[model samples]
Structure formats: structure tokens, C-alpha cells
Target: MKEAAKGLVPASSSVNEGAAPLVERLIAAATELRIGVERLENGVTVLDGGIAVCGSVAAGIAIGEICMGGLGRVRLTTSGGAGAAEGGWPTWLEVASAQPVLACLASQYAGWSLSASKEEGGGKKFFSLGSGPARALAAREALFDELRYRDHAASGVLVLEVDRMPPPVVVDKVLRDCELAPEQLTLILTPTSSLAGSTQVVARVLEVALHKAHELGFPLADVIDGDARAPLPAPSPDAGVAMGRTNDAILYGGQVHLTVAGGDEAARDLARRLPSSNSRDYGRSFADVFRDYDYDFYRIDPALFAPAEVWVSSLESGRTWHAGGIDMALLRRLWLDEA
Candidate 1:
């Protein structure tokens, strides 16, 4: 029953400033709804005393809708560095629709910082870019020219930074006829540690920029971390596993060979039960279906000291199915489309 904080706020007026006010406002808003905010220095905020909503952005939106537009207690986990890199692109485009004329400052200088801000004025949200003075000036001009030719409202600015000179400066100068301000800007800094280590340095700068954007209320839906990559757990020993294309005349190889008999009623039954939508819609006898089917066999490369053979028998014969290495249950699941 708690209400979520509304609106995004700038992270810092200056680089060294803490996010105390932002956190305080968020806490106050949530507290009104009987929710607690747990702030962590590692850039994580936990919402408690309500339903714990945890998942991707899509999941969060669904949860929000279910709560009747209410924001529930949630844990905002970083999805690695995905948010830091590609986040906010859509938001920038959306804002550009309104304020057609805006400057976008991206830094190619070393040791520069970047930030974003959102303000409500004239019944619309105005986003601003903050960065070093040089990048800010250039971004202001570029925005003006973009607005003249475009039909969208001049929303705000997009700041992008790199190790080299940014394109905004040239763009702004080209449209010098229009005057732009230093305040309506977003600054993105791209710094380089060294010419040899440019790539690594650029990557780090990008990550930092993304984090800063998220802190500034850019709604970075998620942040995926690259360092958390890990392998999937092995399957259970008792679980039957088979990997093959669905509803296709195919051959499987392992400790045992399962030769699907063409006309056998049991084979037909098994084929009928194959895990596939096609089988349900277009039921066909296995014999008539795979008339020219050729059985291909392969050995379980490592050789699991077990008896293996291909079972080619007729379904009408009622022959007792015998296979040394075949898991009957798994075969049933695979053919029945129950898996």
C-alpha cells in the first residue's frame, strides 16, 4: 500500500556532493506510504515493508500496473553494466520530440565528469546536461540547429563524452546564428588514460557516465554487470535429457540408438505423441510420413560401458520394448510433447 517516489532529481550540484537530499526525499515519499528505504553506499537502494518486487524492467512495470500504479518495495539491482552503457537513449529521444532545438555536449577531454538534471516548467519536463564548461558551450549551439529543422519540441540536451573531440562543438558553430545557453546542456565525458590504453579507459569512462546518469533519475531500467558472468549448473542425474529438432525425421546417437519404425503402431503412437504443435494439428502415421527415412546411428563418444542397440520392431507385434541404454520415460516425454 506504499506510494513510490515521483520524479527524478539531479545527483549532485558538484562532483563531491553526496546524494543525501535525493535519498532523504525518496525516504520521505516512501515513508508517507509506510515503506522504509535502505540506502547502501554501493549505489543500491532497498525498499521494504511491502511486496518485494525483483526482476527486469519489464517485470517492474508489470508489478507497478498490478499495484494500481503504486510503487512497491523493491530492490534495484545492477544488471551488470548494461544500464551504464545503453541506458537513457530512449528517454533522450522522447525528450527531443518537444524541444526541437537543444545542445548535446559530449566530452572527449581527460578527467572530466558528466551529469543530468530534470526540471518541470511550462507543463513539460526539461532535461539538462551538466559537464565541463567547454563541452557545455558546444552542446548549447548544436541543440538550437537541431530544433530549427525538426518539428519536435526542444526537450533538453544529450551529453555524450569520448576521448576525442565531440561532434557537438562543430555542430554548434555551424549553427552559430542561433544563440544557446550554457545551462540547457548535458555533459558526457570520455577520458583516456593513455593512447595505448584508450579502449580500456573509454570503456571505464562510459560505465561511470552511465552510473552517473542513473543516479540523476534517468530511469536506467537495469544494469547488467560484465563481471558476474558464470556457467549454468549441471542437470540432475535422474533427469532424462534429449536435444533434437522438434517434429522432424532425425537420428539420435548416444549409448543407445532409437530407430523410429516407419509403419509400427507403437512407432506411430510415439510419433503421434511427439512434443510438437505440428503433430497435434497434422497427425500422420509414422510409416506413411517417413517412408524413405534412413536410420542413422552414432556411439556415445566416450563409451559409457553399457549395452546399446537400435530397436526396430513393429507396433502391431506387441514386442516388449528392450533397450539397454534408453530411458523409456524420457523417450515418452520427448515424443509426447509433454516436456
Candidate 2:
């Protein structure tokens, strides 16, 4: 595998640079997108998708694209609902990327952890896992080292799934790590209970697949192209429920297709192990699993965090392999109620 990986070309594009223009366009169309915009005291710009405004589906799709560092496309589409009632969902978020590794792992993965506690002089307890193109500039996570990638850009954009503004301390940390002036930073806040949040989270279907494949020890550089989609559930007002719905959307209803440069055997192995059904905790709704685990997210099986279905095509052998199947019954149970 290491020998084959040498043939892979290094990624030369800057994710932060690629996303800067998209960030400008998103802020430029804030009013039309039905989102709120504000500037903090420190001169850092903030865009609110659901906190102070009623965010729309359009804004979510746009944010999803930005989250992928402009390397991926996100769109709203209708599901065919085959072999199930209403096909479990009428709406879905479809995502595609030619640069799957960089788009999903280097950009979209929420691998950076930021937090503030009252004891540490923070105004209140605050925590969020940072995502989007800005992570490439910070390069704080070890994953960046493994990928041997970093970004150099004058501007940066970050997406946070939180209901409130980040503490100024956390913002300061971002400025220091990315070496960006306050004016050069933009923070986007999307709460899970909002339309925008649900859309953007479900849009991570492809990213989740890439992340799982990486975790399973597959050679990421071999993954050349990818596409995926998952059912979009109504955002719940309850925080826990909202989180579960987003996760369950991928665990039960998401599907992904990956194109790789590896041999047929390697591609078949990746396909076999890249689905949620392979985990012991696969039979229940995510909400139920969370409750059973006493709401401690880490206590649950990490293997359960994958798309329900997958397809892998090996360019080397001109063959394709598939594994897993979507569970529409479980999706309908979680998404719909017969009132």
C-alpha cells in the first residue's frame, strides 16, 4: 500500500484560500439567505444561521458547500423512496467531491476542539468542535500532520455548531493559532435545532465515509473521488433529539460511493468494513443508543459512526464492490409518527 501511495500527487490548493470567496458570497447574501450577521467587539465577523434568525434550507446548502472548502458540492434533492413507505424521506442532501480526501478530512471533519470554562475566566462554559476550511490554516490537529498538508492564507473561515457566540478567549486562540488579524477571521454559528444545522450536518454523509475509511486503515490518497447522500430529518427543538436525528440520518439512511486508485482486493476490503451495520450497536435509533449509554458519546461504539450503505470502485481493476443496506424502517421510526 505504501508503494502504491507514492504514485499519489500532493494536493497543492489552499483550502482556506478556496473558501474565502465563498465566505464573502455567503455574507454578501445573508439578507437573501435569511441569516443574521454581526461583528464582535474584537472586530471578528460572525454569521448566525439559526441563533438570531430563522435560517432556511438554501442557507444550509450554501453553508454545506463552504464547509467542504469549495471542493465539494451540496444540493437538495428528492428521494425515490424505493421499497419503503415514502422511501423513509421525501428530501435528501446530496454531496459530491472530486477531492474527497482533502475536502472531507482536511476541511470538513470537525476534529478541532475549542472550549472555555467559567473557572478559567470564561464568561460561561462553552464548547464546540470546529470545522471547515479554517482548520487547514490552524493545523492544530495531528490529522494534518498525517496528511502532510497545511494552508497559508491571509483570511480564514470557521463553522461552529453552537447556539451562542464563542467566548472571546476562544476567538483569541483561533486568531493566535491561525496568525490572522481579527478582521481576517469569520465565524459561522449553526445550532443543531435549526434548519440550516440539520441540512449541513446531513451533508456530511460523504465526509463521514471518508473519515471511517481512514479510521479503518485504508490509504486515504487512494480515495480519489466520492459522492454521498442522506435523508434530511426535521430539526428537533430538543438538543439531544436534534443531535440524534442528524446522526441517525447517516447511520441508517445515508449511502456513499467512492472511487479509488487501488487494486480490487483493497477496494473490496474497504467496502466490506465501511458501514454502520457492522457495529454491534447498529439495530437501534441513535437517540435510543445515546440514552442507553447514559448520554456519554464516547461510551458508544465508534464503528457505529458510518453510513448505512457504501460502494467502492477500484480504478486499477475496473471493478466495483458494495456492502451494507439502508434501513428504511428504522429511519421511518425515527423520522415519522402516525398521528
Cα error, candidate 2, residue 187 (Å) = 0.2
Q: lDDT values of the candidates? A: 0.23, 0.88
Compute the lDDT for candidate 2: 0.88
lDDT of 2 by residue, 266-296 (tens): 8999999999999999989899999999989
Name the lDDT value of residue 9 in candidate 1.
15
Positional deviation of residue 117's Cα in model 1 after best superposition, in angstroms: 31
Question: Number of clashes in every candidate structure?
Answer: 32, 1
Instruction: Show where candidate 1 strays beyond 4 Å.
Output: 1-4, 10-339
Residue by residue across 107-134, what tens digits does model 1's lDDT show?
2112222322222233333222223223
The candidate scoring highest on lDDT is: 2
